[model samples]
Target: MATPLSAERLLTALRDEGLTVHEYREWRTHNRNAKGPWGPVHGVMVHHTVTSGTEASVRLCYEGHSTLPGPLCHGVIDKAGEVHLVGHGRANHAGGGDGDVLAAVIAERELPPDNDADTDGNPHFYGFECVNLGDGQDPWPAAQLLAVERAAAALCRAHGWNHRSVIGHLEWQPGKIDPRGFTMDAMRDRVRKRLGVPPDGGGGAPEFEPFPGAAFFAPGRSSPIVTAMGHRLVAEDCGRYQVGPGPEWTSVDQESYAAWQRKLGFTGDDADGIPGETSWTRLKVPKS
Candidate 1:
């Protein structure tokens, strides 16, 4: 499909959405060629500058930090909800995430785990970094969350994607926190509701499953037991993984489970690859 809107067109569209627009001095060229199809854009990734002022956040994203190089995102949303376009094509945000999740977003299916930055996310996702502390203590101003929701909704509408396409920086990165305070799931929930998708993980009945204390896992249609287990782990601070307790499990989950094998001391490799048994034993779970 053709590009939804040119930078100029996007600026106009954003303005129509009631957001103030600012064009950064050092942004990606509007006509720059992209690596892949701009259509089928699965979703939008929300981020926090983790910096104080909008100017500083803009400069950092435009110039990039020492660790990330430069041009870290496509747009920067300020405290007042003004959106500043930084880069257009492949703006360097979105490292690796689970391919399954990417596909699910594209298909408008329920999302799975975001495993790695292995794929070229920049080509497929529009990135936005909002100016906020993301320290969890910093309350998400009503304006900021509104801006995020609007921005995400606009992008999803343009791309024909549902709110499930919306996610957070923390959701993509393991051992890293971002856009804190508000949960990624919660943010997506608002988006989903707005888009008219069933907020309860789509039309599929939620499966309750146990998640091993692993680095990541993805749940699919199955017993609510497995779904409940995975949900518990995510709630208790487990990274998102795209393994359904039934099948399509990856080696990573196995590694994650084996690493914590000793946590289930008496258990054997039974917990090594499965998302149950020993791995579940290691988890400090609350009664449901």
Candidate 2:
């Protein structure tokens, strides 16, 4: 267990990670600690605001919605990679999630599927909301993505945690997916590479699936491949998904693939939704 990073220390840690942080209104004194306990933090939780535009997203995160209270998260990471500090202790992010996932985070091990929701996560995790449309096609710019990695890495470093200690909201709660464009696994890899440390016995290295060939994506079946391709589409700003890049193929997949082909300067029949070897290789589908 780790004590929550002090606001001062938090700022220092982020800066040490080479980030530009902006202190929002009354951030030092803003919190919801009076409503609950805010200690024994185990890890950082990453989220994406379904809203776009940095200023509005930051303000909304700071002032919250009618259903949720203000200071929705500890920080709002914008498209430029700048971090806007909103709250310190006990932000409103990370609601009830799988207790098993929390346990895995504490133990620094591979996480189990988050199928249950018996745990209230608001009190134990520091949360950061990335500015995005969360529509899978909104595009997570390199700057914003790096800021998230740094933010999570900063907290992990301060708490003596390895990359395993970081998690996405999707990894915690059931039926919730704020972050759509990137994989938490990829983000954790970013943290690992950034931190340049051992895995802290979090288990063996993860296996990445190489491109199985363009023929493998012919649909008629559900698998992690479709989801992986979808992630790559979103990353390349060719995403067309409104829901999940889930295991099964849908029109979203075709549309997203076609968009990617077009972006790559493919035209006419060459821009057909079906992926070719050249485009498939470029997608870099998480090595899978």
Candidate 3:
């Protein structure tokens, strides 16, 4: 059993794991804590939205159906690997689940078949509703699957839990078959491997470098990674220089990246010739 991480910490953890997160309106405050307890958390629960269209699915997860109330899950992982945070505590996603399953998760052991619904899982698990049709044929894109693995791994790393701490909705509850088209055990293996690779290149807890936010591109700061970003900018046909987007950052590189941002339709301060997080991520600059 573990205390729930604060909302701010959860966001930081996910980002540190290299997952793209988008905070929805009032997401920090959105939760089902008024109805029940939110902690003594044991694990992370993964689910499928049975829905298409990221925006609609995210909204639905944030605002549940009339019978169920709202704050269905903590986050909605979309097809493009973007995680839209919807709620923070005691979400409605995981209902009554098997006590045996909870025991297994807590022990970090192999899960037994979920044959009973005797435990309150909402208070025990962090939920992530991934967008999918649940039709079996709907594809799970590589990026989306990576997001799922990273999201789950980030939580497990935080709690010092192993792969067994991650489970699918179907694995936790009876009469529920969400998160189809992929095996939970396989996903856990992926999470396990991620946990082995330290974020800072040290064999310990992750110490990720900050994401290249807009502030990272402010004048006077220099990094060799700037050259990689310049190459990506040139490839995208946004280059605006006489020559050399060399190993150093220059006004030309900033202007070119800003033009790329404009091509992507950002305006005003957002497009003020600076590299913001979203645009920088979309650019996918290679590691230096």
Candidate 4:
């Protein structure tokens, strides 16, 4: 069992981990503690907002709908890698979840599937709502994902817990998947690495494919990789397609790639629209 960190300590821990944190209005005092207990904390829970635009998402999370009440989460991690502190204690993020899952988190052991929702997760977990559409195609920028890893690792470090103490919303609830673009296991690997622990020891290494190279985007290529790249391009707001960045590469893809190149300050022949090793690597497009 772990005790909840004070607001000051939590803020300090996040900052010490190199996160860009923004304190919202009355965030230190905002919470739903009246609804339930907020002690004996177990772990950190990560979730996606399933919304867009940093400002709007932050507001929505800070001030939830009437049905849900405000302070939907303790923090809102924006696309730019900034953490907006919306509330401190007992935020309305994690709902009922499997007690067994919570037990696994406390033990720093591998989790069983969350088949039941009989536990009060809101009181036991610190929650972060990351900005994302939650659709598999929404695209998780590397910065945002890194922020997630750092934030979770920060909490785990403070609590003297391992990466197994971190879990996605999908891992807790019966049928919910807010973070769809990336796998929780891979995220855990990152946190484990940050914690100086071998990533494949307890739960084994995640099987996510490595990022494909620029050659994978060559003309006549019609794999799901192209579609994944297009999704990433669209997420970066560099897509130039009027119809589709479909499986096959077209002039539009070249045009879009050129725009991305220009965005990265490439000029002359360098901005000829084809993906290069550098730009493609920077994009960090998720492997299909």
Number of backbone-clashing residue pairs for each candidate, in the order shown: 25, 2, 0, 1
Clash tally for model 3: 0
How well does model 1 score by local distance difference test?
A: 0.61
Candidate 3 structure quality by residue, lDDT tens digits, 1-288? 666877876886699689999999999999889998988899999999999999999999999998997798999999999999999888999999999999988887788999999999999999999999999999999999999999998887655566778999999889888899999878977886777632222123322223576667766677877866765566455767677567667899889988989988999888877777788766656444
User: Candidate 4, TM-score vs. the true structure?
Assistant: 0.70
Better structure of 2 and 3 per TM-score? 2
Give residue 185's error in model 4 in angstroms: 0.3
- In candidate 4, what are the lDDT values of residues 1-288, reduced to their tens digit? 565777866886799789999999999999998988887788899999989999999999999997999899999999989999999888889999999999898878899999999998999999999999988878788899999999998887665567898999999999998778888988998898887665556753212225565566677878766765665565455777776667898888888888888988999999998777788766655434
Q: Determine which window of 10 residues in candidate 3 has minimal summed lDDT.
A: 200-209
Clashes of 2: 2
Give the Cα lDDT of each candidate.
Answer: 0.61, 0.83, 0.82, 0.83
Count of clashes in candidate 1: 25
- Sort order, lDDT high to low: 2, 4, 3, 1
Q: Is candidate 2 or candidate 3 better by lDDT?
A: 2
Candidate 1, which segments miss by more than 4 Å at Cα? Answer: 1-4, 26-40, 196-200, 203-288
The residue pairs that clash in candidate 2, if any, are 209-287, 209-288
